[model samples]
Target: MIAIDSSAQPIQALRFEDDGATPNSRFPVLLYQLKLAPAHDNASAFESLFAAHQWTPLWRAGIFDYHHFHPNAHEVLGVARGQARIMLGGAAGQALTVKAGDVLVLPAGTGHRCISSSDEFLVVGAYPQGQEDYDTQRPETGAHQQALARIARVPHPEQDPVTGAHGALMRLWQ
Candidate 1:
């Protein structure tokens, strides 16, 4: 177990490996944690872990891309500070706003996106594993198409074909 004492050092980062091994099989459990340091530094504790998958906090001041994960991976987002708006489905779909101490779970195949930001900044914890592909039946909406146009400057690595949602696949080491 990794312990991050924010009271002392403030920002801390660690990754826990799964004992079992399989190329494309999902681990029974995946854990992550983020603790805010004082008002000194804005460093992220999970920067290394998220970097492995090219995932990072959307810090730019503008509407961002809406991303959806594959059908096999489950995602859990824990907000440590500030507030964020979670949009479900296409960009113009339903919106759920989350704040500090709130946890949002995205089951496999659930399409989601993020919007809205605060001055306090935000610390998030996300765990994604397993192998799956995008759902082709559900296509992107006109509003989502329009939203994507503005944020086209940023590149999406694992974008889906139909909706252009971004996500990564899990890889196991022998």
Candidate 2:
């Protein structure tokens, strides 16, 4: 079943179409269990699942303390270990705690940061459509307008980063 936690007002989501944040696209939602079987902390598990969905692996690292986003492509973050509180949609965003078995499908240009986390807060990140290149754009960049345009041009992934095809991501994203 698709789990929707609206506890953060508009759920685990934030729209950045105002002020000086992202220009278009709604922030990602946290999925409690997108894939029940591959919900462990094994690197092979995450690599295999993302590969099956064709969402190429970009990095395997913990979230950074600084706020950032990708303006060239969307991303998927799987919590391979531990838990963390993330601030999404720039500084004025919602705070979400995600643990192992949880997945975050972030749209292009959605801001995110690791507010606080446990010692073993490992994450496996992937990009859509076998993409590998990305730019780390801060919300206060001078090229903010260009970033927004780039975000608008980014194509939506044909498959979900976790479940592919008709997964909850497809339903929520489209």
Candidate 3:
């Protein structure tokens, strides 16, 4: 069974400002340290959990090193193996280490990049079912205003990837 330890609450809500080029989010990023059941297949554990909450697990891979964000959709990243140092909220953002069982819920336009990782680093990336058609946006000279408009239009996910409809996202996002 995939169960989150109630004690391992989300770290904090991280909100990034629009740094000119990178149109970061108004909604804060949420990090949840999960305690999953022992399973042989790590990726499947995450995929199952997210799917149960109506979040579609679309990819299995390591995070990209280049800075990027999604303006048309929100995202969830579940750390399935090893560990990684990820930079969150663009060039001026913070770098945090994530290990197995860590889950990050990023709002639309929230910037992120992989700084470093262990050899076995892997993650299950997911998006809201109807909002899976996501676009990756890199910080460019004239794309800020357009990205901001799109980010504003991206709807808040109906449910949290880790928790279901009554998850923290429902409270924090509103």
Question: lDDT of model 3 at residue 172?
Answer: 91
TM-score to native of every candidate shown:
0.38, 0.82, 0.94
Ranking by TM-score: 3, 2, 1
lDDT of 1: 0.36
Q: Candidate 3, residue 93: CA error in Å?
A: 0.8
In model 1, state the lDDT of residue 146. 32
Candidate with the greatest lDDT versus the true structure: 3
Residue lDDT tens for model 3, 1-174: 444453447566777887887787878899988775565677898888899899999999999999999999999999988899999989988899999889999999889999999999999999998888899989875988888888899887888777788888999998
Error of 1 at 58 (Å): 15
Best model per TM-score: 3
Off by over 4 Å in 3: 3-8
Q: Which residue pairs overlap in candidate 3's backbone?
A: none
User: Which model is ahead, 1 or 2, in terms of lDDT?
Assistant: 2
lDDT of 1 by residue, 1-174 (tens): 212232222111212221111111122111122344545233243333343444433332222345543333444454556777766544334566655534333333345556666766465544332222222123234344432332232222342111123321222111
User: How much lDDT does each candidate structure score?
Assistant: 0.36, 0.71, 0.87
Alpha-carbon deviation at 171 in model 2, angstroms? 2.3
| Whole-model lDDT, model 3 | 0.87
